[model samples]
Target: MSAGDLPDPAEMTDQLLDEDTVRQVLTEGTLEISGRLTDASNLTLLAVSSLDGVELECVYKPIRGERPLWDFPDGTLAHREVAARRIAEYAQWDCVPLTIMRGGPYGNGMVQRWIEQPDDSPDLVDLVPAKKIPRGWLPIMRAVDTGGADVAVVHADEDKLKLLAGFDVVVNNADRKGSHILTTAAGGVLGVDHGLCFHTDDKLRTVLWGWAGESLPDSVVEGLARLATGMAGDLRLEMDEYLTVTEIDTLARRIDYLQMSPLYPMPPRGRSAIPWPPL
Candidate 1:
């Protein structure tokens, strides 16, 4: 199926298109670059793929367009993005959208199905007046806005975001800014921009620290158990396609630690625990 055959994201209650269909359309369909996301750190293009009279809107991040990073090796960000989705899927979480590594007009890159949020959707994470913290919202920290007004960085205490936070821990996501969380009209929550994940070291910076030091819910513990079990099977082999052997081993260890501890991790000591521009 091509992009044209997919239902409009807003009109769908669940996933607009199934993962397998998206994979086929993105891999085999013809791609046309329609626009660019200028705010992204890397070269991110907005594009459409067409195949068999179907069309789907997707984000294209070509490997050649990836910017050099001091910590990450050059040209591997797109691979990491695809790997993140695989890891999340393995953990039995659908928080990451369908992503595939494919050749595009810009050569080899990562292509992910675009998630459309409704216009009236509330921010899953945001900076709000310190005193006006919404009931049930969890405050992560306090800071000043551009006008020097007191503002608190906060996120919802919802299960969808909690699951994503757990997935971030397993992948060692180095950047989990508030804006990375996408809430759909269908009530599905997903995360994007995962090129900075799956690092070999402990770099789990994120805005979802409200659960820090709390015992992980049974659901999260179960997901960790699933991941721990997969480390010895095809999961490791699948991850090896995108991450180095060392990184894969480290990921396994992270899963083991979480299963043993079963608690949300505390912010790392002696390093920033939150990404810059937290929102």
Candidate 2:
């Protein structure tokens, strides 16, 4: 969808200053504004309370140069809008409606669906106990694995995983880190961060690796096959209007590989895995 299709920020004027709202600033020069919809970013998150009450989280170019790493230009809300729309369409998943909100006390920002944190939240990255090693990845895989018996060793909600995988494939997600997967109190898992996604490269960098060399579950394989066959048609059509032709082609290749090699090995460490916002 184009910028013209997005909701206008002027329409949300009064709600933006609600008293019940809370705002917290996050690292990497992001500000979390609660209560109303605001700007768009490479990554934007908002938590909608009731129907009208909304909380927003936005990641944008850092205003200050204290750390000396931030470099992207400010006021690029249009780029994020395109990425979010393409991802939501390709995966058929719901995304927080995004819009260009006023900048923070610092730089430009974006508003997105703000997800409420679960009451019983685990440390986002430290959930996998040290002893679990690669085994911890099993449960996450099972929750998302779609292949079959030889490949599917654990049990998890398959439908959710399929959607998540589809989102990854569609966005060309380069980073599926542990922290980015949020587990809600309602026992739902949500994926975030699409800024570094949709790149025209093999950019799948995830921490879940237990099923590295194992055959994929039948269901997972089937999902990949479906995506592969429909990619050039339905999926591409959905993304074409929002994404570049090259970006869509990369997504198609990833789906094809997933279908052709049910047990595709993970990319070797150091070869593809790099730190986010690489220094």
Q: Considering every candidate listed, which one attains the maximal TM-score?
A: 1
**lDDT by residue (tens digit), candidate 2, 95-186:** 32232233554444433334457677643333323334343334433222233322222212334443454455445566666556565555
Model 2 TM-score, 2 decimals:
0.53
Candidate 2 C-alpha error for residue 76, in Å = 7.5
Compared with the true structure, what per-residue lDDT tens digits does model 1 show for residues 21-97? 77877888899999999999999999999776667889999999998999998999999999999888887888998
- lDDT of candidates 1 onward, in order: 0.88, 0.45
Q: Evaluate model 1: give its lDDT.
A: 0.88
Q: Give TM-scores for every candidate, taking all chains together and pairing residue i with residue i.
A: 0.93, 0.53
Error of 1 at 203 (Å): 0.6
Error of 2 at 191 (Å): 0.7
